[model samples]
Target: MPTELPMFPLGTVLFPGEALPLQVFEPRYLTMVDHCLAQPDRLRFGVVLIARGHEVGGGDDRTGVGTIARITSCRPGGGARLLIGSVGEQRIRVDEWLPDDPYPRAVVTEWPDEPSDVSDAAAGELTDRLAEFADLFARFSVRQGRPALPVPVWADLPGTDGDRGFALARSLPIGAIDRLRVLSAPGPGDRVLVLCDALADVVAALRFRLADPGGAE
Candidate 1:
């Protein structure tokens, strides 16, 4: 069934199973939050990247597609600060947008699922690479004393047999358009390839940062 949902367009696109933190202070968004809390289903909203348009108001080309996100925790700010932790659930295709309230509202339908087909060899390679990336991320977090971020709870995330490999590929440090392409990929294998491409850039960026004087180890 098609449903009306409140949309939160961001500078970045979030993937399912990824965590996104936001500072919500706008009055419309505050109302949206209140609505979600009061709803019986505790329905979540979509987090989408604002593509080729204005961010604060309406944009010229905003993708009707987005990932569903759940509000896990929220910290109220004295005046306009609202700290929120959200996790992406699934993909949705927006049918039509209604208006731009404090936040945007839209009528949407659930996007069709795109499962992946990964070969054993490719899967294995993905596993090793993800493990390396995960380790580096963990180390960097520890070295920098940054708050620990949550990884997926599912098994086989960075391994040969699990969907985790695909997840990690989509979630790594990548640009919004690349992330959107992964999200829009027709199948899992293609998505994984997109992830691999992003992984390459991630490696290059990490190396550059690490080599820099201001970059952490």
Candidate 2:
């Protein structure tokens, strides 16, 4: 069954188990936050990627798939704005988009990943690919006179394979579209595969940049 959820369309994608920190200055979103805080048990909202517009002022095209963000903390920010701390809890598929009375609203259904076995080999490959991508990205950053990016420690990742896969996807230095592809994957196995493919693309791009220091491709 589809349920109505307050929607927040951003320029970036949020995957499950990821932290979402937002500065709410707009009147519409502030109202939405107030409403959520009023309902202690239902302090959550849906976050979708803004496919064709800005995050503020309205008139944005949003994607149908999104993640549920659970509010963990809220406080005041500079000059009438709000500081919200939330975490992505689950995936949701928008069934229908309703009028934005004060804020965007959508009728959505829970979209859980399908059950699938993730073999040891597949998991190993994902780990290897992530490491390779990180190394190459660090080198690329250094070559550009920038500091090397911090890499996530494998041992510190989630214990479960599924959770770990989502974490890996979140750590990738890829664009929103590629991240969305990982978020939309059917299951853990498929998500890992998509992430690996994205990592490969990033690695290839980094290598080309490193080789051709000043030449434009």
Candidate 3:
């Protein structure tokens, strides 16, 4: 069933279980936040990555896949502004884009979660890949003179394969496009596939950096 959902087209992608901090300065988004807060049933909005143009004046095109963002906190900021923190709850696919009545809206369909897609083998592989990727990133940071970059420990990650997958992917040094690919993936297994491919290239670069004698080892 197609449902109309309030959308916030942004320059970034929101992954399920991710926390995003937003600054509400624009009148449209300010009003949007007010409306969301007024609704007791759900203080949520949809966030999609802008395909073209900017997030400021609203001419930007956006991708169909997005995540449901639940408002966690809303604090008063400098005059007419709000500092908001939201956590992604679920994924949704835009069936159609409706007119921007003050704010953008979409006809959306619920994106189903298929945990079974994340097989035992895939989960194990994802965990291993995350560890290697994290290690490489930490080393790469050290080479760049940022010695304080924390190395990710596998045990510290979320217990579920799905949560761990999003957490690791979010921490990657890859570009926004690759991150969207992971966010829009149909299931956890598919997200891992895309992430693994990107991770391979990143890890290779990190290895090359560490190999150079001039670089910090």
| Highest lDDT model number | 2
The lDDT of model 1 is: 0.72
- Which lDDT tens digits does candidate 2 get at residues 61-153? 999899999999998898989999999998999999999998889999999888876777777787788788778877777767788867775
- When 2 and 3 are scored with TM-score, the better candidate is 2
Tell me how many clashing residue pairs each candidate has.
3, 0, 0
Error of 1 at 142 (Å): 13
CA lDDT scores, all candidates in order: 0.72, 0.87, 0.81
lDDT of 1 by residue, 1-217 (tens): 7988888888778877788888887677877888887865865998778888755545546886788999898888678768888898878888888868656888888775566676666655656666666666665666667964654422445553224643664556677878888787766677666666666677667666656667774
Order the candidates by TM-score, highest first: 2, 3, 1
- The residue ranges of model 2 lying beyond 4 angstroms of the native Cα positions read 144-156, 215-217
Segments of candidate 1 deviating more than 4 angstroms: 124-166, 204-217
Candidate 3: worst-modelled 10 consecutive residues by lDDT: 147-156
Which pairs of residues clash in candidate 1, taking residues 3 or more apart in a chain or in different chains? Answer: 28-102, 116-188, 157-164
- Could you tell me the C-alpha RMSD of candidate 1 in Å? 4.4
